[model samples]
Target: MKIAFVGKGGSGKTTLSSLFIRHLAAHEAPVVAVDADINQHLGAALGLDEAEAAALPAMGAQLPLIKEYLRGSNPRITSADTMIKTTPPGEGSQLLRIREDNPVYEACARTVRLDGGDIRLMATGPFTENDLGVACYHSKVGAVELCLNHLVDGPDEYVVVDMTAGSDSFASGMFTRFDMTFLVAEPTRKGVSVYRQYKEYARDFGVTLKVVGNKVLGQDDVDFLREEVGDDLLVTVGQSPWVRAMEKGRPARFDELEAENHLSLQTLRNAAEESYGNRDWERYTRQMVHFHLKNAESWGNAKTGADLAAQVDPAFVLGERSAVPQPS
Candidate 1:
């Protein structure tokens, strides 16, 4: 499943993004964590040094790079439309490239070894890279389409996006592209206030967002936020002075604590469960009349499939099983 995390800055969006990536890695899943926040810092928060995070451009940065490649060094190409190239990555590479416009962007993909497992991260370089005039340009629809196509076509892969904070065009636009969105909110008053707005903004994009209450000191604080929001509170990450200390450049350890033992991580796992639908695929697929009819024989659910297709889209469904005449 492809999931995106968004919230106000300093609201723990990246922290949760990194932690989720770590959690998925431990499960032996092939996961790609895209740091879409143009300003960066996800790598460092996940335990990478400055030089490491500097090498990647969250997906946003890759867009301009694609434009540059299509334009090339030659001044003759006035428009990028005809000049773009889609260079497919070679076999055995971690990136399953959709297509490449220029080879420059692929340089952003680097494999890093982490404690839980290895992660391939791409960052959106800070807005400082582009001149003010160029930075004002809007994102291309083609680029967004290409990225979504890649995600949809991939096999058994998961994408976790760390988007910029707030209702800005960047965050709103990116948030809409995800199969699911997880909003990270802290225990403070400002955090809860922003989270309410975040939920509204997510709904504007027609997404059902799940909330993660971070840095909670106790159950009362979590319950209070839930009461105020009046939504199903997914999971709360208990106040982890250790995790906070690490983010601040202080050396704090997570030695004895079980990563899964934390409430925050538990909610994230639950969110993953719901969004991935790995556990409920049977019920979900059964409900999908067309999909169920196609796979029922192979899956040994043909009886249910026949009944479902009869109730839903019957003509083609019966024809598919060679048991009835197809429609004209």
Candidate 2:
């Protein structure tokens, strides 16, 4: 399953993402955690300090190599530079297997030690001074977008991503890529407003989204969330001293976590697992093709001087498991 954690800034999406990854890992499940946020703090939320987290390879910095490797022997693609982020995988392209060793993971991911178990972590990296006024954060996120587009996961394997806050995820077709999205919302009006934005934007697509209420102290807080998001609310997490300790760099085990909070995490895991389906894979391919053509028409054709729309092999549904047939 491919899952995304998103919400308003400071809504603790990173914390929930880290906890969920650790939960899945502790159970001996195969899971990968990708930090797609421009802020680059999911590593810290997991366990890494300032220096350690910064040392992991940033996917954004290694875009060319990834494109080159995934481009594989596909005859449709002439060069890595011409393969935009929205490029869909087709016959002869190198597809990714979840939790399996691959060149992209080798170049960009790292193993993080959590008390419960362990997780494979990757980040899009932080926006740097060099990128100041020159690149949008989406350019960095493009690496992750392309990675997800080519990735194929089974029922047991999981990929959990910490997405950029709020409606910003709607900026790219990446928003439509997840099997499920957990939008963390606080009780405040500002937090619920983001929920409205996500609900409105994702409703048109087949995006499966649920609201996870964060930092609730009482029934009133829960009521506020229910009223704002209605049936979209999946579960609520109360403030936890255990989480506070984790935030301070003190380690924790799931056994020691607050009982209710632990249960809430399990609920989230169940929701994600239940969301797995064979039906959505076709739509995933179309979204990639749609964005590719949109980008091609807007700028990609001028930039690459080739018809980028030809990159789409209509019969190839990216996340679907089947034999690929070459374009005729």
Candidate 3:
């Protein structure tokens, strides 16, 4: 199952992401967490010190190598240099499984030990001085999008992503990649505004978006979120001294979580468990091909000086384990 945590700035999406990751890891679920946020704070929330977090290789810095590895021996993909971020997986392209022994994970992710067990994490990377005038954050996030596009996971496996705040993810098809997206909304109007934007944007795509109300102080706060979002409000995390202490670098445990907070995490876990059986490979494959063609037409062909549409093998299906002959 794949999960995305998103929200308005300071809505504690990163904190909630870490909590969910911790809960999954502690329960012995195989999972990987990706810090796709430009703010880049998921590591600190996961208990990594500044130096250790900085040491983990940035996925953006390694785009070329990742593209090279993921292209594999696909006949349609003649060269890695021709591979754009939206390149969809075909018959011969390499596909990723969660925590599989692979060079991509070795180079881009690091293991962080926690009270339960260690969890693997990867980051899209920080906006550097070089990118100040020259780049868009989308370029950095493309690594994650491509990874998700090519990844094939079993129901027991999990991928948790901490998305960039607000609707910034709408700039690309990244928001549509998750199996379920938890929008961490506070009781404030500013919080629900993001939810409204996301719900409206994703309504047409059939993305499963549920709300996790954070910082709820009382029934009034909970009522405010319910009144605003209705049944979409899956669960709420109330004020938590334990979370504050942990985020402050003091030790904390999942068992020590406030009753409501712990129940909220369980609700999320239950949702994930239920969704594994509902995997939609056809929709996933459609999305990959859709974005690939869109990018190819938009700028990929001009940038690569070749008809990038050749990268898609019409006879090849993403989830089916079979091969098709290369077209003449």
Candidate 4:
């Protein structure tokens, strides 16, 4: 399952993402934890030392290699310019398996050794001064999206991503790349407001969003979330002293998390297990094509738009609901 955690900046999304990855790894499940946030703190939350996390390679910096290798030696892809997000893998395109022996994994992923089992960690590099006006954060988002598009994970395998905060995720189509999205919302007006915004934006694309109420202090906090989010609220995590200690640089064990937190985590795990299934590749491909064509019309050229449209699988396009109706 490909899962993403998104919420208000300080709403504990990254913490929940890290804890969930740890939980899966503890069960000896194969998992890849991706830190796609510009802030890049998931590594530390997953128990990596600051220096070790900093030493890991940035997946964003490796975008060229990803594109080159995934495209492989396919002669059909004559020019790199045409290989946009909508470009589907051809016959010679490389497929990524998360296991160590897979060439794609060996070349691009880093193994983070945890207590129960090892999990993979990939990060999008932090925004730098050079990128101030030249590039948008979507450049990094595009890399993660393309990599996942090429990856083929088994049923039990998992990909957990800590995405950028709040409604900013709507800036790019990357939000649609996940199988499920967990919005870790605090019980506050701003938090509920973001949830409304996210739901309204994602509803049009058929995205699944489940809200996890975080940092709940008492009944009032839970009540607020219930009132605002209702059925979308899956679980609630109370404020944890153990989590607080960890935040202060103490070595708090995952097993030592508050009981409520553990239950909330278990509930989340069960939800993911129930939701796991094959991805709708046709739907995803159509969505990608739609996004690319929209971009082409607004900022790209006619030839590029035609090239993107040609990459769509004909059968998928025939049944695609991604095209917006034209106004008469």
Encode model 3's per-residue lDDT on 64-114: one tens digit a residue.
889988888889999999988889888778888785667789889888887
Better of 3 and 4 by TM-score: 3
Per-residue lDDT, model 1, residue 138, is 23
lDDT of candidate 3 vs native?
0.87
Alpha-carbon TM-score of each model against the true structure? 0.66, 0.96, 0.96, 0.89
Angstrom error of the Cα, residue 78, model 4: value is 1.9
What's the TM for model 1?
Answer: 0.66
Model 4, C-alpha of 201: deviation from truth (Å)? 0.8
Task: List lDDT for all candidates, in order.
Answer: 0.53, 0.87, 0.87, 0.76
What is the Å distance of residue 93 in model 1 from its true position?
Answer: 20
Measured by C-alpha RMSD in angstroms, how accurate is candidate 3? 2.8
Model 2: per-residue Cα lDDT over 1-328, one tens digit each: 8999999999999999988888888788888899999889998988899999989899999999899988888788989989988888887898887766778889999998766566789999999999999999999999999988888887788999999987899888998888899999999999899988988888888888899999899999999899988999999998898888988888667679888877888999888888885447777788788888998898888888899988888777775464233232
Tens digits of per-residue lDDT for model 4, 155-246: 67889999998788887677877778899999999988889999999998878889999988899999999999999999998877887787
How high is the lDDT of residue 223 in model 3? 94
Query: Once superposed on the true structure, which residue ranges of model 1 sit more than 4 Å away at CA?
Result: 57-105, 137-146, 153-156, 169-172, 248-263, 278-328
Candidate 2: worst 10 consecutive residues by lDDT? 319-328
Residue pairs whose backbone atoms clash in candidate 3: none
Error at 112, model 4, angstroms? 1.3
